[model samples]
Target: MSRRLEEILSNPEMQYLINNANNIENIQKYLPILSELAKKVKKHNTWFIEGLARCRVPYKDIEKYIDLDEILIDNCSIVGNIEIIRQLRNQKQDYQDYYVSSVIDIVCKTSEKTLEQTNKIEEYLTEKKYKYRFLPPDIYVIEFKSPNIKIPNQFGVYRYIDTEIEKQNLRIYFLIAAENNIIIRRNSIIEVVYIENFALFSLLFKFYRYTEKDKKDLEKYEKSREGLEKIIDKGFHEKDLEKIMKIFGKEERDKIMKKIKSYVDSHPDTIYKKLLELNIWFYRAY
Candidate 1:
């Protein structure tokens, strides 16, 4: 990774939330992304973390990380409930003649408990040496990718805070890399979800992990067989192939694309089924 990407991923505040993620529900009400991000952490070998929502001052070259003292999942939940109450009390009824009946909308639909998924993800990533970044709380958590903590600079959120929930309004500036750098704005109401609503996040995480693992394993095995063949045909012998494949670096696998195609032709179809599912090749050559 480049230094800028690394620095962003290793930002202390984001890392702290990942390192010490909270599982308790109430605290999630406070900093809800904990649970949502926890699940994400469990899914892919991507992303970084961030924290300290209340502090508005931006630090330049902040040598240290900013984070909550503890997981605070439960505390955040309590904060969410409080915010709800505040919203109810602050409802506007400008005129007795013009009072209109309206249904209250949930600012965040996720339960505080589910928000801990972020912590789990952090634990998983730290173990794998992957990277992530928690965009400043001012930024919305939008456009979640499998195994990543990326937010486009353009995904706009209403971007405010409700003191009771300590939940800041997040309008995700989710955009494709193509749309990120340019400066035109879209006013359409794009559906947005906050960390407070962590339901089903686990499912997304599980699917992502399963897919990533499959990709890695397929690449590793295909590369192994390729090396074995080279041993038989080239200068090296079978013994050399055995030794080399055994010492393969535990990497996510790429450069071995042709090795995978080889399996489709010369090896048993079952051995290559998983790779076929991953779409590693645009079309499997016979």
Candidate 2:
């Protein structure tokens, strides 16, 4: 077998399909189309293939009706198979919502130990006139939506903590809330699960549409931070400082560096503390 075909066969999802197939020989004929789909999706494309299988699309003619574009548009035309494909497409959309809701359910379940406490805390917050809402239990957990944090066109679970709350009770109130929430940030799918004492953050999916400006901005931001740290340790004469400041452009270079140096000298710990603060803000905002 060719290297690419071998790679596809070795994929865990593909292996599962192969090992469980009623006739392995029938699967072989579909490999070329699967390979092409995988290339288009930049992954195993198991979900698409499985959808076809579930619809009972014929192995010999699967490629004739279904292509990446048709799959994307949910407009595949299969003779005498239109109804099944239509149903599958509807299920595919519903499945996305179902999948997100399931993840939120699992995340909420992790905090079951603190649910009673959370309810009590919520009551207290309510009495104190804090702004919040409790979603239907079937859909999501109690949500303490802070007016302080808002991101347009995104939905996520957020933990709200009032500094006035007693430190002992703070842990109980730290609960994430939102059902079927997913963050789609600039062509990337960001999945974040936060329980009382657990957290999982990952870039779950990418659409590969990063622009040149985005890449340059990210690179410049990272390099500038690294350069600032070196300047803090080794002083203004640091050799690479000039190169790093050039990223900011000639007009703002000297003024910006001077301002940064002044702040660093006066409050050396601010940088570290600000990073932690930003993380907290991100968790609350998203």
Candidate 3:
């Protein structure tokens, strides 16, 4: 068995909980063990939580351990236990955090429609309250948090931006996760969408073929290839290119720009298609 499965089974209490998930008496007897498993085996804790929900354990009992958003999303199905669903709905309504509330709203609303298809998720995004954009397959939402916020243990790519509002700078971040959820924090965000699991070599080859040019100059700046690819993926913004130039120095910047301009001039159609792809991936987050 896989190490993760073994770890779950190794804990006899956890194993009992999973086995008797539909038994409310058993869940209540080992309730404290659920919290311990949540802390110890975080990656697989969802299984235990799902069991609790399925068995109709009180939401308040599980709320202290598992995240509300996680439980709601993981078990947001009409087939899911109705009492647990009602408890989660009440909990969601009581949340004052805008991001959390909005996320719950999106998931609950979309789940009402259908959770089995991507197109169904896209269909209900027309609501004015939360303007969610439809991301293509393999593209994911990346959330950012302002530095002033005291959110701890947050993880993602980090980028800094300068703003004139109050003469203070903000440290923006890009939170990449395995879900297609939108997370907004106090109206401060940098960029939202990125190519999921981007393959550098494959993108480079596509770039070369699109430009219909030799790879000599591209290979010359081996160190800058990744940076260049990022710029292109983000739709060849001048500011992004300038940032790359600032990091790699002016000479390398000029060469990179020259190569890109040559490609744009030579293959306008190809470049336009790329920009369209970017537009479809990125939407205004409000």
Candidate 4:
């Protein structure tokens, strides 16, 4: 066994939990041990969350989850929640990174699509004597694989192992283990798609690549409101309506118009520009 594996195996608290697998209550009894283990393995420089998952210690403490999250998010190059695309406009950008921007395409739990394939993957792992375990909802970890095999060049890190029938190149790691089938490499291109999973409570995946055009558009939108704010601050000029309509799309213009109507009914002398300014500020405040 590698030194890393030895360290995990030799952990007295971890051994206690594994040996007492017959009793699920041991998890709560030994959470502090598990939290300590999480801190130790966190600096491994990968997102595997390795040792904690390896020992199958289910931590139930919300604070412990927050503590672990602080470690992972700090180290990740980029991270984002999985949500409806339409909701993104209203959601604030929650991110911290050392690099510019890149969106990584990730496909997870796709193996669960068909029962037959899921069984096949389990059988494959058994045949290879792979050390692996399932973390609730969908995360599956492959702990032990044949050593000394060369991993692909573009592969930044192996985050998770999933059952993928069709092989595709993704910046995110997805591997289905087989004898003499470990080698993998493919075209590194980016495409955006949205998939649904209601089981997860919050954001699960991280997007790595953001195109120049995408970044420019986001920057433009952020700065776009400033000029419009200035125009609205002056007075209700006829040209102000034209300017506000051009800055935002139909939905936004409709909102502006509705607010303007309400404001006109209340303050007859106030300009339509005041309504437009309030509408823009309302969304920005979020």
Candidate 5:
């Protein structure tokens, strides 16, 4: 039993074991002997808050593989309600290390998607007997899989200096379990139609490999802007607009910029169209 517990403790993701104990007092009541497990960590490196998934681990052995300072996880949960817990580090070399967990609410997309193959993945994980015990109950639960996708190295997640705006990399995390807990683990990459990362050329390469685009729509318009913007009349942010205009020495490009701005001011939600409009000024993620 001690060997299993030690093995569980040595897991890289086990810093928040006891704190994730469904009910700390209740867990302690049943696990009266857990207190004597011997403190491995000089201080707390990871903060596991209540109602959040946590992996129980021996902080002593695994510190070599990971860094608590860089933050192993910001907040990882499988049961919906996306409030996340963060890892905290103390500056002192004294008092061993004590970590107290805290919670905060922030708005971010959880990559909610309706995927068909999702059930195939979830069902596979459930039947794998991957179950382990944190206390008596199962610690980790497979919430659901993200869309059936893989980040193709070629997805256009790049950009050049010619671009007016830096391309964004569409990064995401996968929820996973280890040592009987729903810890956030890097699983497969999120396969997206349009990548935000600045590797457009790479993505283009992948596009050819997948060359199985018999059914894939390439000419469809991309999702346009769904955001609000500052309204301007015949006048506008001349300096800012000028900066954009300077990118293209051609007057034709500047003329197109004006047309794009007019479209943006009117539609306010045609970001993709606006992007296309500024093809000269805008950059591709390469």
Candidate 6:
């Protein structure tokens, strides 16, 4: 096997996905496409290529195999649950990088956790290499409101503490891409997860390692997998796209366009999938 192919398939999570085939048809349907991608476009996008392997079947490829929304709506037991799942799936339409939802949504829906609190929240954020910015208790009042720390020209969050009341005391604000500013006075933010120009697929490798030794214990393995499915469903954020644009580094239009064209030419199917799904033209300005 080619080294790239070997690298992609050697992943224990990918192997588990293959072994736990919901049906032979899912495997028969998407494996060849993944194989072709592993063999052909391996060099251009190691991150995404590996992601394809981690996901086993990218989102669109899963559609080629099964209609997940329809299956849930048809087969689910409760009416309220079906609506909730439908809404959840709709919210995740743009972020559906892979076929994870269909396989794991059942496990997710049964959990008592809210949509925001997926199990092992800290672990996944850690895998993404997020830098946690914890403010001192009076951080917002002293920083943003009072100007103690000079804010950098980058993305970050700032807040103010309202000691006037016992509850609802924190007021949160954010600087997006170091320019667009926002403030949230009502809702409390548990924490901020931030990673710079990070590839979404990298999480899969970490997830794989987390689940590698649990094959003998089916329940633990499936629970971990369910948590991962929640993370995947959150998908890549709009801010992440801005970060992704920096992949090739900043340069003149002609140079950037050339690199993008080369990428699109070399990885037609993958690029096409991204363009169609995300409505992003990574090749050129126009």
Q: Which predicted model would earn the best TM-score?
A: 4
Q: Give the Cα lDDT of each candidate.
A: 0.29, 0.29, 0.29, 0.30, 0.25, 0.29
Q: How many residue pairs of model 2 clash at the backbone?
A: 0
- Residue pairs in steric clash, candidate 2? none
Kindly indicate the candidate among 3 and 6 with the higher TM-score: 6
As a TM-score, model 3 comes out at 0.17
Q: All predictions: root-mean-square deviation over Cα?
A: 24.5, 24.1, 22.5, 19.9, 23.7, 23.4
Q: In candidate 3, what are the lDDT values of residues 1-286, reduced to their tens digit?
A: 3454456446776544444332222223444544343343333222111101012233333333223343323322211122223322443433221111111111122222223322333332223122333322112221112212111111122111111112222111111122222222222222122221222222333343434333432332233434433434544344433332333344443444455556557556443234334322222211
Question: How does model 3 fare in lDDT?
Answer: 0.29
Tens digits of per-residue lDDT for model 2, 26-121: 333444444443353333222111101022223223223223122211111111112222223332332222111101112232223224334554
How well does candidate 2 match the true structure in TM-score terms?
0.20
- lDDT tens per residue, model 5, 91-180: 222212222111111111121221112232234324532222212222222121222211111111111011011122111122222111
> For every model shown, what is its TM-score relative to the native structure?
0.18, 0.20, 0.17, 0.23, 0.17, 0.19
Stretches off by above 4 angstroms in model 6 are 1-133, 136-251, 273-286
Clashes of 4: 5
State residue 283's C-alpha deviation in candidate 6, in Å: 12
Measure candidate 3: CA RMSD.
Answer: 22.5
Q: Which lDDT tens digits does candidate 1 get at residues 1-286?
A: 3344445447664465433322222332323333333344344344333322333121111101211122223312212211222222223221112211121112223433233433433454355333434433323333335334444222222112122111222211101111011111122122233322121121112223436653443333333344322222223233422332332222312323344455456556434434433332222221
Model 1 accuracy (lDDT, Cα): 0.29
**Residue pairs in collision within model 4:** 102-208, 102-209, 103-208, 103-209, 104-208
